[model samples]
Target: MFEGLSHLARDAKAWPFEQARNLLARTLRIRLTDAERDLAVVLINSGKTAEAVATFPALAKPVILETGYGPSGLPHLGTFQEVARTTMVRAAFRSLTDDAVPTRLISFSDDMDGLRKIAPNLPNQAMLAEDMGKPLTVVRDPFGTHESFGAHNNARLQAFLDNFGFDYEFVSSTDCYRGGVFDKTLLVALERFDAIQKVMLPTLGEERRATYSPFLPISPKTGRVLQVPTLERHVDKGTIVFEDEDGTLTEVPVTGGHVKMQWKPDWALRWTALGIDYEMSGKDLIDSVKASNQICKALGGVPPEGFNYELFLDEQGQKISKTKGNGLTMDEWLTFGTPESLAYYIFQSPKSAKRLHRDVVPKAADEYLQQLDAYQRQEPAQQINNPVWHIHGGRPPQEGSPVSFSLLLNLVSAADAQDKAVLWGFLSRYIPGASPETHPLLDTLAGYAVAYYEDQIKPNKAFRAPDEKERAAMLDLRARLAAMPSDCQDAELIQNEVYSAGNDAGFDPLRSWFQALYEVLLGQSQGPRFGSFAAIFGLPRTLALMDEKLGG
Candidate 1:
């Protein structure tokens, strides 16, 4: 893990040996709770290990990490999760291999898949309605930019990944089929058609089994993928005879874009063709992954190792669906939070399902900042356990903002800050010489705070008048603060004074006092540390604001 270090030349005797041993120990202690560590085992752990991975391609060839996308709809946050997580695993694998093993991430788009239904989130609904049962590459682009709907969404997906700075090569299923990329693989699948069927048949119902074939031909007449039964297979010719919808028998070469396999078989074909080393799928695809593994083996190819992560639930706790448009879109998240925050959220537990909604963004952003702030103080061992370490791919940025997003939102509300400039005006005074150029993270956060305040916090605000006892406490607190030196802006000192006022006022359960402060002053039931807020807001202005709130 530490390849280029000059620890041996250090003045301290035996220092190099001690450092080398510590580094070696860390490499051995690869068992971190970080999801990426577990996910990275795919590079080392082949799927199921039913047959040992002694010959698994990753151990020999350059590792290929693959992520699949169905171009039926715009890529969502769930899609981002897979790509980001896969990238994280790639980083982990690199760390494990000391950057010696080469790797490539392929973002494969299934544009050849027939359009089963129109996505509700897309435009030009009537245009899509006519294209049902046709391959997505054949459907007209609703956005009128790309050649087809599939291409348009593919571009959108690329743009999404590009915006997030992901490292991957995009591949289209249509290109693979038409350009002979899968020609040999298709022939292999055809030679073992019955073996593939043996893996797929029992899982189907009677009606489906009656018509099921590993290959779904693109009808020469209608141009739609036909689901009819295969009449015959000529293994030597690499062709299949299938009944088209019009009842006439059709013979077509399986290679060169004439046919595509069913979902499981298609997955297996891709694995065989691309020699994928690792991939990750959502929990719903567990059975499909299993079937694909068996089909891959039947084709005399090894199935890639994978991590089956839990699916995301929507606001109603229902499974997020592309067709239903129930989940939070990736654009919606970037609207309120930074991409780093979203990455931090994805870096968390993968086995457990998460509720994906706009409401979850704030907490993710705050937690991300908390991690970044803590990363600087942590040791090398503890740093690897920190999500920020993985989030930044081992080298975290040095400049971090200590002010929480919540604090910025509260500042936005209290100051009636209409834009980032207004917030900057307060921030400039609070932290002298701290400008947008020097601390861009805080500056970006100021803008986000303004947007969040306008969209989420402002409408929900409900300020209440404190009762008589609470009023007395507020009055005493204001008096205590008023007695402090005007130039003193110590948050801890201010907090101590505020606490004494609450206790001296005889309020039981100290938390209630803070809750009262939040509700009465901030127009919310909870808030940032009041001392920090007051210090940042300026004590004189805070006392003036308190008088206005107390009606004094």
Candidate 2:
């Protein structure tokens, strides 16, 4: 369906050309996730994007995609997932249009926001406590790495995004408010202050509703962003009168960083000011999105249309908090998981809630490899369905890793391999002619496997002797594998033999059978597919390990 599509992604058969092909194929009817596919069809048909936000919007406007970040704490996995998922949609949109519609992603930092409370994880609590109600842009950098805390966090976010090579423009709320970029929007907000109040007041409690003002002027005396009530609005003068804490009425221009709107209004103001076309947030922000949309309309602008992905949860089902460091950090994942695997995890079930924990890393790594391996054989239709396609922006790595990350961990456990070289030794025998250079993915995985084994697997390993039934099964399985052809490379064939031994030994649930193998052989509660592990780790070696465990 897409003849010249390969030319669009990259004119190469090596993963580079697949994105273009996917896009080129998109000139035809494309089917994907409900929200994305609907958006693409609307844009491709060149219809109104008011409902979806920006398809030939206003005749010549470019497609704009935005993701927001708060500088309250260092960046986390949630932050990375937001950008990665947005970028995936952007790629999908581009594919549907064949790059005819130019799209831009804005990585917005809300530095103008005040730090309500010091995060428990941030250092120098005494210093942060002193700057209580000040805008994050002016708060002293606890890290001593940037001009302010906002700058420090923003820098970390940028570096993190850059590490993943995301295509986005970094925008600071402080810069927009102070540099006259938001001047016109602020004036509109001042003119329609009552309209904004109508949208915001009902959402707040009685106390907040009484003191609520759309415009939060920066305190002249203390340099803090004040949240007092607006006594008067001077739209003609482009200003508002608000009483300071000392009961003194202060009038400040709504322009030039002198005043900032409360958050919901600020969100609407940004949409109006920047003409943002699309933006996505977590489920927790659904009410905020609704309010922003109404406020955006009140300010004579359409709210950007996007979906609300469910919030990520920590292992215990609580919302993942960047400030409290309650879940897996991107840096933590990178320590033992490949970037591709991490991206794949983020790409999966974006609209569904996920449990973010360290244990998910190895599984993610294996799943990503399995998907990448599947991509080469899949047609264009099937390829797009794979997360790797979107994770790599259509251009995934062509070389598939020979060993699964889980299997590698098991192999490391079985061999008691403490180093990469030791793991590589068994891997060399597993896949002849493969080396760290020849299989780059495996090479990356080898390092991660070592780290994961030491931190997550090795210390937790609990090898127990097999029960009477399991012992008989293991010995039979060992005998079967021992008699197999020395040059045997078939994983499923070896796997069948292992299953036969377990079945013949009368393992009713079969799960218990596999569990016994894991406990007795690998010293773990769970492990990779026994057949695959045997094939990869070598049958002879596996049999020897079993004999040792069984006292043969």
Who wins the lDDT comparison?
A: 2
Candidate 1, overall lDDT?
0.80
Least accurate 10 contiguous residues by lDDT in model 2:
1-10
lDDT of 2 by residue, 1-552 (tens): 222232233333322234323433332222245556566555544532233334323323466778999998777777888898888877766654455556789999999998898877788999999998899999999989889999999998999889889989999999999999999988988888888889888999998898889889898888899988888988789888888767788888999999888899999999889988778788988999999999999998877767788887889998887557798888888999988888888877777788988999999998989999999998876676678878888788887887889888998898878788888887787787888888877888888998999998888888788878788888788888878896677899998998899889998898888888999988898888899888877777887888888993
- lDDT string for model 1 (1-552, tens) is 422122221211221123323322233233233443344444333332212123333333467789999998778877888898887776655554445446689999999999988757678998888877889999889889999988989999999899888999999999999999999989988888889999999999999898889899999988888777789999888899988888898899999999988889999999889877678898999999999999988887777767688888899999988668797877888899999998888877877899899888879999999989888898665666678877877778986885889888878888978999988877888788999998899999999989988888889999899999999999999999999987677889999998999999887998899999888887888877888888888888888888888883
Off by over 4 Å in 1: 1-60, 120-126, 506-508
Provide the TM-score for each candidate, comma-separated.
Answer: 0.88, 0.88
- True-vs-predicted CA distance for residue 373, candidate 1, Å: 1.9
TM-score of 2: 0.88
Worst 10 residues of 1 by lDDT: 3-12
Could you report the Cα RMSD, in angstroms, for every candidate shown? 7.2, 5.9
